[model samples]
Target: MTTMARDPKGYYAVLGLDPEADAEAIRAAYRQRVKVVHPDRDPSTRAREEFRRLMEAYAVLKDVIRRAEYDGVAPAEAGGESDFTPMPVACGTCGSLTAQPRYVVFRTVRSYLIWAKLGRLDGIFCRDCADHAAARASIVSWLWGWWSLPGLILTPFALLANLFGGSKPRRENTRILLRQARAFLGRGDLVLARSLAEQAATFARGPDDRARVAALLRATDGAVSGHHRRLKSRWRPGGRVFLAQALPLLALPVTIAIFVLIAIRPWDQPVSTVAPIAVHPATVGEIRHVAVDGLKLRMAPLPGAPVLTLLDRFTTVEVNAATASPDWVGVRTPAGIEGYVETRALYAGSGSRFKTEWCSDNRGAPPTAGEILSRRVSGDHRLLVHNDGRRDGVVKLKTLAGSTVLSVYVPATFHIGVGGIPDGTYRIEYATGTRYSRGCALFIDEMQASVLPMTVTFHYQSPTATRSLTNIAEVWLSPQSGTVPRPLPLPPDRFAADD
Candidate 1:
C-alpha cells in the first residue's frame, strides 16, 4: 500500500485516512465518505470535497509501486523536489520512443461521412471519461462552495491521480508503473520517462489515468519547472495547513490552479437586468371546451349562463388559480372550451380557458390565443401568456401575425401582471413562409435563439415538496425547428393608412 506523503496537503489528509489504511479499512472509509459527500445525499459542499479526496487517495494506494513512490517522498516536503531528476531527450505529443516525455493526451473521436467511405475522427466521451468528469465537477463544485476551507480547493485534481473514472489499471503491474515513473521523473529521460509514466498509469487501480495524463503533461511542462513553484512554497512554515491545496495541483499539473481555487468557493448568482415574465389573464372564449362529469364546455364564446352539461374527455379548460374547494380547475379545451373540473386529474393555475392555445412546458398553466400566437415577448415588462391544452412535447403559441402558430421549442410558463398588453394585437407575417401543417403558413419576422434564465423556487427542501425554494438557474433554450423565419421588419409605422 502507498504511504502518506510528507506533503501535508496531499490526498491522505484530504480523506482523513491513515496512509497505511488497508483495503478493508479503505473500503469502510469509502462507505462513510459516500454518506457524507454524495451530492444526492448531502446538502453541504465540504462533504463532497472530502469524498473526492477519498476517491483519489484510494486510487493511488491500491497500486503497489505508485503507493511506494508516494510513500518514499517525505511527509513534510511539498512536491518531492529533492527526489526529482532532469531528462535530456525529447518526446513528442504522439510518438514511438524518446528520452523524456513530459506528458501524453489520448483523445477519442468519432466521424460519419455523407454516404461515403472511410472516416477519420469524431468527438465522444467514454463512460470512464464522463464519470471522471462528473467526479471532477463535484470537486470543483465543493471547492467553489459558500463555506469551505481554502485548503480544499486544489485537492480534487491531486486526488484524481487516483482515478480515470471507475476504470482500474491492472493491479498486478502496479509496481512496474511506479518504478518507471520514479525512474523517469527522477532523471528526465524521454524514453525512460515515457516508459515509466506509461507503466505507472497502466497499473493505476481507479481514476489515476497516470500514464495517459503524464504523456500529455510531459509535453506541456517541457522541462519548465516553475509551475511547481507554488508547490515549493507550500513546503515553507505553516505550509502543512495549505498542503491540501498545493499537493493536488502537482498531481493534475494544469494551469487552472488559480481559477480552480476560486471556483471551488461559494458564489451568488447575479440578478438580471430584465424583469420576470408573467402569466396571461384568463378570457371567456378560450374556456368553452372544458368537460367533466357530464359538464361539456362550448368551443366558442357563448352567452353567459349556458346550461351546465355532461363532461367529455375532449373538453379542455383553464383556471385563474389552483383548486382549493372541491379541488377543480377551469380548463380551455381544443374547441375553445372552458369551465371547472376535478383538480386531481388536471393541471392548475391558468388565466385563459381557450382551447388550442399555446403553452410552455416551463409554464404552470395554459395561455390565450393571442398570447400563444405572439412570441419574442419584451422582458422589460415580463411577457404574459396562458396555457391552452395538455399536449405533451407540444409548444403551441400565437405570434403577432394574428395566426395561432406553434414554436420550435417548449414554451415557458407565465403569469400576467395587473396591466394588460400595452397594444392589444400586433400583426406578424412570414418572409419565407414555412409549412407547419397541410395548409398553415409559418413565418419568422424576428426569429432568433435564446435561453431564458429561470429559477424554480420550491416550498420545501427535503424531498421536493409542493412548496417553493429560492434557487434559480440559467435554462438553455434553443430551436427544435430547423430554420429561422426571415424578417418582415414592420410596424404600423411601416405601412400608411392609405396603403
Candidate 2:
C-alpha cells in the first residue's frame, strides 16, 4: 500500500490537489495526472505504482461516502448512486466475495480523569461480519467504557451507535433486498427471488433503480412463492444472540441486587437472647423534669406501646416507682395524666440546671461574647447585643435569606460589642438557656429562643472627606420597653447548633 492509503488526508495530496478541492476538481486533476503516470504509456514499474496510487485517490474522492470518511465527516445520507456497485468485494472479516458490502465504523471510548481515548474498528463487511463486529464493540464498551468523567458522557453514545448500526456508509434496505434477490436468482431459487424482487420494487426510488427492479420482477414473473416474511422473535435466555444484546443492559441491576442481599443477609441474622434489667422496689412521689424534648409518655414500658401524650422540655412530673419497669418510671403530669416514661428521659434536678459537672465546665469560661463564629465579609459596622435574659445567650446575625453571617456568645445579663459585621439587612436570632452542652454546643436540657420580628439594617456612610460614619445597632434579647418587638418563639430544632 502507498503512504496515501495509510494517511487519511494524503489521498488529496496523491491527486495533486488541496483538501478543499471539489469532486469536479478532483476528477479533472486525476485525469491530468493519469496521462503522465499511465503504466501502459510509460511501461515502467514506478509509473505503475504511481498510477495505482492515483486511482486509489480518485476512487475515494469521486464517491460521497468515501470522501466523507476521508474527511472525518459524517455524510447526511449513505449508499448514493456512486457508492453502490453490483461488483463483488472481499469482506474484511470472512474474506469471501460479497456483492453488498457495507463500510462501517464501530467506536468505543475509555476515559480517565484528565484524558480519554477513542477506540475504532472500521471495515468493509458483509452482513454476518458486520453483526459480529457491532456486537463485539458494544459489549466491550459496555463492560469497560465508563471509567472517567468524559467516559461517562462519550461511552453511551458509542455503545448505542455500535448496537444500532455503527457510524459509516451503509447499503439501504432496498439495495440489500435486491442483492439477496440476485443471489437467490443465481442459485435458481426462483420462488424466493421473485418474493424478494417484489419487495425491492416497492422500496426502489429514482428511474434507473425502479427500471432495474422492474426488469428483475419481469424475469422472475409467473414463479409461485409459498414462503412469507416474518419478524424475528424476541430474545430469550440461553440464546447466543439474546446474551450478546441483553447482558450489558442487565449487568448493573443484577450486580446491585446481589450486593444488597449479601450486605443485609436477612435470612441468617442471629437472635438476641440477653435478659432485660430486673425491676426495683417501689418509691413514693418524687419530682423530676422531663429532661428530653418530645419525650413520649407511653401507656406501657414497651416502645411499641401507645403514647399517652408528648412531654416537652422542662415539663414537671411526679415519679411513681411503684408502677415502674426495669427501664421505665411511672409518672403523673400536673394535668393528673399518668404514663410510663423511659428513665433516661427524666432528670432529678429542675430542667433549668445542668445534667452533670462536665456539662457546667463551660459556664465560667464562656466563649468570648464578641467572637465571630462565622464571617462571610468584614465591614465598618458593629453590633452590640445584650443578653438581659437570666440565661446565657448566643446571638446569630443571619442574612434575611437565612444564611448565617456571624454568631456571638453573651453570658447572662452581660453585653458585648461584635465588630466587623458586613453592611446588610439581618435577622437577629437569639437563644437563651441554662447550661451549655459541649456535645450539642447549645443549652440542651432547658432552652428557649426567638428571632427579632423586624429585620435590622447596618449601613456605612462617608458624608465628607474628613468625616466618616459607621452604623452601629444595640439589640436586647429582652425588651426593656414595649417599643421593641417581643421575640417570636423559635423551634428547638431551628435554634439547635450544627454538629
Query: Number of the top candidate by lDDT?
Result: 2
Model 2, range 1-499, lDDT digits (tens) per residue?
Answer: 2333324446778887766666568889988999999977998899998898888878877864455344432132222434222322345467575544456788977666666688987765766777787787877777677787788778778876776667753244355556656666766767766776776665677777788788788877757545544322121123464357556666766887889998866544322213463333224587777666689988987889999898876577898655435567788998889988877666554343433332465434446555555567787677888877788887888787777778777888888888888888998888888666654456754678788898889776676534333435888877678665578998754664332
Backbone clashes, candidate 1: 114
Q: List ranges where model 2 is wrong by over 4 Å.
A: 1-58, 61-90, 97-107, 112-124, 148-150, 157-211, 225-242, 254-439, 442-499
lDDT of each: 0.36, 0.67
TM-score quality measure for candidate 1:
0.20
Residue-level lDDT for 360 in candidate 1: 23
Point out where model 1 deviates above 4 Å.
1-88, 93-105, 114-499
TM of each candidate vs. truth: 0.20, 0.38
Residue-pair clashes per prediction, in order, are 114, 0
* Model 1: per-residue Cα lDDT at residue 165: 29
